[model samples]
Target chain A: MTVQLDFLKNVLYFSGLDLAEIESIDKLVFEKSAERGEMVLLEGESATDLYFVASGAVKVFKTSAEGKEQILSIVRPGESFNDVSIFDGGPNPASARAMGPVLLYGIKKNDIEAILRNHPRVVLNVINVLASRVRHLVSLVEDLSFKHVIGRVAKILFEQVGGGQMGRGPRLTQQEMAAMAGTAREVVGRSLKALEEEGAIKVDRNRIVITDKEALKRVMEVSS
Target chain B: MAEMPGIDREKCDGCGLCVIVCHCGALTMVDKSINIIETVECDWCTDCEAVCATGAISCPFEISIE
Candidate 1:
């Protein structure tokens, strides 16, 4: 149908395909939905399919035996996950959980392999995405190793602001910020308090306003 | 048994940042030094190792079977 083709056209991997190829690929795709907080994939599960996020968000994370969680990345709409696993036919490296109600498009490994064979350029795209993920992981490792808590918090805030001119950023809970910073909630609270004391930021009921962007950058620099 | 993370006492500044980052509660500070309290609870997520400011926590070397 035209609706399905339109959706396929928006996906980066299928963007190069013509109408006929899109339609053929669409036939091989299936839709899946998950409620908020639902587990979409489990770490160590066999990778049989690659998934595209049609709507909503999903958090990719690894869990400790004690039920502690370390989030790897968050997949937003139009992005995809499990490409590497599908290519290697290996188990999922991490688990994915729906942050909210989510809709996804899934393609089986065999179908994706066939498509890749026809369009080698798709391999380049996959590699590009994987490379970016590696870069992100490397930065995360660096942040965890070298950056202090305040520096990590500032970096995360700047990232959330999209590195644009500072203003009222997205509303996020303390717990959410803690998870992203790879620290405890208390640590985030203390850091935010310190930033607030320095007139660098303002914390107002689930939202943070960056009052002085330069001051925040100074905090990161001084710590680094 | 899985290899546990080893702490380099010489490098450890005892900042307790690793203790705060260790979600599994496997790490603790005693006498201004980091110690693995319960090895069984450690998931080797490398969270503590990643957050150590002094690179005090080193994960066990992993051998690739591939």
Candidate 2:
């Protein structure tokens, strides 16, 4: 119970809550474990809970009629997903799949609703989080429509490096990079090769090293 | 449909990303190649597939949750 309280404190929606409030919430949440590639929630299913990541990651994605997957967001530790579904009292907007062996803590919609009724401050924090999600979606659409394939690839690389917070990041497969970049895998491969040749990045073993930040930035925001 | 996860030998570049993320300890690196140590007990966390930069590991099945 104490451990759960610590984890809940890190969540953006509940971060500002006092110790007593967090303790109250700790009782409402339940634990779930999902293996990698397992679908945790299905699109169009009735939403029941909001999930927060404790460890590992989750990918919120949508599938077209033809079954092509477009990942909308990757929820990392200290973050949550399915907020829109739970709050709006609607079907899941997208399916959630575990990116790895993920441990999650979820609060039922009814439990969270009760908390929201009592805590107006939490509603404000939730609104801020939703607004940020909207901004991220807007940027995603803009990237898909306006950016060239190379630019998109560069953008993905930039983000993988903790948005310039880290000089290196896990080397992603071309297929994974293409999914994030919204381009063909071949295009992503070509882009990586180009970046490598230009000394903008170096793929050493299992990690990607940002060799030149300025060069990478230039490619990420390509005007053409 | 292939419900079981399988490693594509042609695609597996032996980067061992699969082994690193397998919380189940089912995958191991041998001779610079990935080998499934426990074929049946895989917790199916698909991290092996997600982390494989070469598209080598894949679980061609989706768990239906209702």
Candidate 3:
């Protein structure tokens, strides 16, 4: 088994495939690299390839007409992005950019179609990934419509703290948090301060802790 | 609570991403744990706290926005 196969084995869309199918994909995939903050795919560009992150992170985001940016997801290594365009034979729904220096493996759309024709498992996996993304979007819409900035901010922080675990969770940048909460960074900063005032969280130089999980959850429960 | 962000030695999980982002020389990882030197005052940029997932580093100051 080649290293590429091993990496493909772990991707969300490529998971559950046997070694043989993975070997074939290795032939069709091409390697690409991008510097930090470089554009990987642009919105409205006709779909040409399905990209998988081989290393580093990709930010999938949409821009408002007024030029405000809302990030949808951070596509990490062993994850795929821009599959919507590849699947539907349409332009990209969102633009993607490298969060840092990144390595990517992209399979052209025609080859992806060929693989789908050969492997039914790949088709099912794609369906599952799309379904999961839709469910996440639905939740985001509900939060945007019904939840205030404080609630959204508290919810992200509480979820990231890993519920009393000693030290487990990824580094989430404030900008990323703002994007996830569908608000501006200033709003999130204010929300954090408010959460601390409520005794739900503490942010000292020596320690940033979720002091009261219950309080945090209650704040999350509050609607806009 | 020090004026700038401080590291909770007990709560810190030793993910050095915070240390990497800290522009000030205030934070260091000593043996897989965050060590905040008392000598250097943090600039209070809050970048360290922004990257922390474990809530190990806190970057809060009193702000009145009434």
Against the native complex, each candidate's DockQ, computed on alpha carbons, is 0.01, 0.04, 0.09
- Per-residue lDDT over A105-201 for candidate 3, one digit per residue giving the tens place of the 0 to 100 score: 9999899999999988888999999999888777656554565988887777766655545343454545567788886554566566778889988
Candidate 1 lDDT, A135-176, residue by residue in tens: 877866665456587777877776667664533356444546
- State iRMS for model 3: 11.2
Report the candidate with higher DockQ, 1 versus 2: 2
Clashing pairs in 3: A204-B6, A205-B5, A205-B6, A205-B7, A206-B6, A206-B7, A206-B8
List the candidate numbers ranked by DockQ, top first: 3, 2, 1
Best by lDDT: 2
**How many pairs of residues collide in model 2?**
4
Fraction of native Cα contacts kept in each candidate?
A: 0.00, 0.02, 0.00
lDDT of 2 by residue, A89-154 (tens): 999999999876788999999999998987777899899899999998887666556658777777
lDDT of each: 0.72, 0.74, 0.73
The regions of model 2 sitting more than 4 angstroms off are: A148-224, B1-66
Where model 1 places Cα greater than 4 Å from the true spot, the runs are: A150-224, B1-66
Please state how well chain A of candidate 1 matches the true chain A, as a TM-score: 0.67
Listed per candidate, the RMSD to the true structure in angstroms reads 19.0, 13.0, 9.2
lDDT: the better of candidates 1 and 3: 3
